[model samples]
Target: MSNSARILIVDVEPHIRRLLHGTLTRADYRVTEAGSARQAMAEIEANAPDVVLLDLGLPDRDGLELLPLIQQKSKAAVLIVSARDATDEKVAALDLGAIDYVTKPFDTEELLARVRVALRSRLVADGGRASIEAGDVSIDLVQRRIHKKGEEVHLTPKEFAVVAELARFPGRVITHDKLLAAVWPRDYERHIEYLRVIVRNIRQKLEDDATVPAIIVNELGVGYRLMGVAG
Candidate 1:
């Protein structure tokens, strides 16, 4: 809700830019507008915004191609605001590290909600905190300790590493490759069974019922997500 949060809107249409600028300005966000991918890249280099609203259709290049560049330039969360409705496009963007996507003619309220969520995720990721809390689970990042319901929950070092990585982006899905690389940097090709075991152990320690997990939810063939803090 801070007016200091910077948002960059990248779209080729003048009317769309004006509409988004007006809406976001009224909502107390500092917004920067870019009409092309080239301009967006330049803005990112000059000063990275907190969040980026990118449209796939650009006069210079495909917006998807610019995703990695943007990510490399800054820690800004990218939200695709394209008119393209193809499922493949959405999947591609999400896989490429986009936090979320919204099609054209999007409802203002929903868009704002998504932006808030993205901002929250960024804050959690960027914050230099010694601990994190979600649901009934609390993790001490410094001590590498975990507790559930105020009771100590033991976890192996590997298990703790996996949980810590997922806890950084609560409510957001982290791809298997990313998780794997984070936990097993040397053995990138390690079988999925290793991750499965760690996840199961985490669930048993944190969830009331491992069979019906509430803390860590698995995305079939994709990755895992830690449920967000309760509202």
Candidate 2:
């Protein structure tokens, strides 16, 4: 049962770690466990796994405090499997690069699903998966094409490039400046209107409720994030 994906499960509870280790191993994933933040750091250094299941309450330090360190150590996707589910904590964890947050007393199916999504999202980010299809929308990277319900949805090169760049960083925010630079190239220093127009067009085509989007979410004054779409 050897899948290509490797996961690191970090928790102080031996029982919980064993349960997760068993489940993931059975699902054909390579699994490793760490009982403390220090140990987790060492594990991360030793071999960067594809995903990390992290608990916020660590014996040595709060998981939030170590988030940056962990991210720096590996390119693995981070999923918070902590007991804390407060709105503030969820927001902060997301802000700090966590792909998803699962609270303690969690359902096994839900946790597994979140882990799957995180892994899939990471694949898209790392360019392992180049195209995405959800419902009537499809984004093709090789051809630089988008389709809606089997029909070609034409977008300006700028608009298509912007969407492609944002799509690469699933569940992560790409700031306005970053988008501008990636899409507009040399004109990024001056043109801001281009980004706004392109984003508006993307929302109109992809969203059922442009006012309250379900796919591309505007992060206020920041930039944008691509949310998981049902495929």
Candidate 3:
């Protein structure tokens, strides 16, 4: 395996593991395979990968049960790759700290793209600098500054905090509760309107058009995601 980026495929099916290994290897990612939750844990402890493609139907244990354990042991990003397509299952995985979810029979290009996004998020999280860039927008966490096209873009402190939080995870969705708890004091955690207002203000300053936004997109009723960012 090359050192470009390590990806662990946690699927019980040998053919599925082989398929993912080939695809990821061709794309320059080092691949590891785990046929069960126990093996997955061992692999994670022995060598933490940059991203984990987890299948929920592990033989030794339910994959969701291992999500937090994985997070506790390593900084690798968890991306659920399962055949279970229930909305509740997706929400449960995301709520339990999985960064992204991809159902079985997924498109190759889409899966690759999601993997790229997950890797980018992991890189940014581990990079130690809280700064991130998306297209023309640049966020400086240390300086608490934002610039668009090399020009400074002024934002309220609250608005800047919101953007900064979103930038930390880049392309991943930050749920409404997570953003609220992160940005506001405990007493204001339920104030979803505050998030909405701050997001609106951020778009007005950072995006070309707030109406048809391209940078920060709403995940319907769930949360918001920072789009088009690279690691």
Candidate 4:
């Protein structure tokens, strides 16, 4: 909705870059173009764009390999726009910190919608938001507080840390290793049971029905997901 958002389009094809530049400029967004991973990184370093429309097939390096590097460079949200539509590739990209993914030949409206979501979330993170409203609960990331339907829900410091980590990346899957490393700073490999116990306690306290969890969803052996990030 905001016309002031800046977008960087990274693709190997010249025509694709030209087409995206026209489409985004017509949509009233400031646009930048890069034809290779090296160029993309250069643009990112010189000035970080608000959102990056990245193509996985790059001439210099694979987009998958460059995704994390981009994250390391800036706080910009990455929306993958590649022709690789395989489920595994999508999962891999999201797991690597991509805000969202769109396959090539993507619908104009749908792609724009996803971009809007990414921009909105960036606004939330950048506006000094020390809290999040998820469903009936409010998470105060600053104070590490949780209130359910106007009532305080107490939790241990460790429990709060786990929930906060997942909340940090809404609508994105956080792999087991990433979560464990974040929460269990010292050693996390042998502490899945500890994480599980804490997650169970969190669910019992916050979830309406712990048996059928809605706020915190488990990704089988991967990690937990914080649902209802809309607050």
Candidate 5:
């Protein structure tokens, strides 16, 4: 999180946006606004805001569904600021990696305080895994380390590259050509066997049962996808 702390406000109401925009800017914080989930995602990708003030009443998609997608792309701390005020909604938001859940009719001072805490909190400062989590397995992209059930699991450079490529876009099929290009830059598609071997090795080390793989799933003739929760 930067010192200025860029904040992205995602809400449909123009009055709410104007209020937040004015309030945040007055406090010396850089702020941006979005009217829908699509716009919110675009702003997040373009600006990489330090904290996201999300509303559940998005015009396009539910804020809950957008939370993980935001996690997948950046290390921004999410703050659910919504009118729902439901216990389940709050719990769900927290579980999805939101740092704070502030109701719509909140005090500006309290909201700002929470944002300050979020920027300083371990969740943003230490940056809890800007990678992917599969079951009990964790793939730390920054550290280039893989952990299964809280135990360090080692892999060769090529194997790590294979896993890292899958980690880059979890739950999406990465083609054989893409994996091959990432790991074996000089080698042609003929080197796909190498990728397969490396994936097999990764499964052996990380999966509970390599025979019935779960963490990394094969895409048959295509390539592979990491079945995990993106951080």
Candidate 6:
């Protein structure tokens, strides 16, 4: 875990900001704190952190509005750390291009894990280090390639698209509809099997221990996500 991976912690609470600052700093992650949307935008413009931990309730403007602006300015991954755990809120954040969301009173370890996964995928996007290797598996989104140990692995066009899409976002739980639309077309949004079969294949190829997959994981009825990476 390199301190080079920077994260912006946006929270209205002073204690929350302080706790995150201390926790992240001790874990060797470069962290920037912002208490308002205005300050968050400013910090994002100046430093361009790799990932943003955003709170929906901001003092000035709605944090959700800043999502598009943040994405437009920089390719930083935004994770909404809000107390709003409603289904609509989660879906809205995901649809608006946020990578993930964590409600208040969340587990610190889970939050850090999501941050790590988001940073890893962002690293791939930034072309810093494109390939991710874990155990015997490797995923290369740039080259549209995958390999197990030293051997090359082949996949169909649709299969590759699904794998690439999920792996690109790492810990982000992309919904089944979202995956279908991105891979197939807007019309195939209801085809759940399209995601399921491809996911099964990807797991079989990448997971050294298929029974306990480390590369890609399921989110039950929600969607699939690529997990287990460092921030």
lDDT of each: 0.82, 0.80, 0.84, 0.81, 0.81, 0.78
- The regions of model 1 sitting more than 4 angstroms off are 1-3, 127-231
lDDT of 4: 0.81
Q: Each prediction's TM-score against the native?
A: 0.55, 0.56, 0.56, 0.54, 0.54, 0.55
lDDT of 1 by residue, 50-159 (tens): 78999999999899999999998888889999999999999999999999999998998899888877776665666534467878898765445688889988777678
Q: Which residue pairs clash within candidate 2?
A: none
lDDT of 2 by residue, 1-231 (tens): 222367999999999998889888877677999999999999887666778999999999999988899888787899999888799999999999999999988888888888888877776667645577645577765345688778887777667767777767656789988898766545525477778878898888877778887778889899998776443
Q: Comparing candidate 1 with candidate 6, which one achieves the higher lDDT?
A: 1
What is the Å distance of residue 191 in model 3 from its true position? 50
lDDT tens digits by residue: candidate 5, 131-210: 57878988765445688888988788778878877776778889999888766755544477788888889889988899
* lDDT (tens digit, per residue) of candidate 6 on 74-177: 77889898989899989988899898888888888888888877876676665445566645667765444678877988877677767766766667888888
- Candidate 3, residues 1-231: lDDT per residue as tens digits? 222457899999999999899898888777889999999998987666778999999998999999999999888999999999999999999999898999998887888899888876775665434567888898765445689999988887567767867887789898998888656745646698989999998899889888999999999999999997867
Candidate 3 Cα errors over 4 Å, as ranges? 127-231
Off by over 4 Å in 4: 1-3, 127-231
- Where does candidate 3 clash, by residue pair? none
> Which runs of model 6 end up more than 4 angstroms from their true locations?
1-3, 127-231
lDDT by residue (tens digit), candidate 4, 79-125? 99999999999999999989999988878878888887777666566
Best by lDDT: 3
RMSD of 3: 13.1
- What lDDT does model 2 reach? 0.80
Give each model's clash number: 0, 0, 0, 2, 0, 1
Which residues of candidate 5, in runs, are more than 4 Å off? 1-3, 122-231
**Using lDDT as the measure, what is the rank order of every candidate, best first?**
3, 1, 5, 4, 2, 6
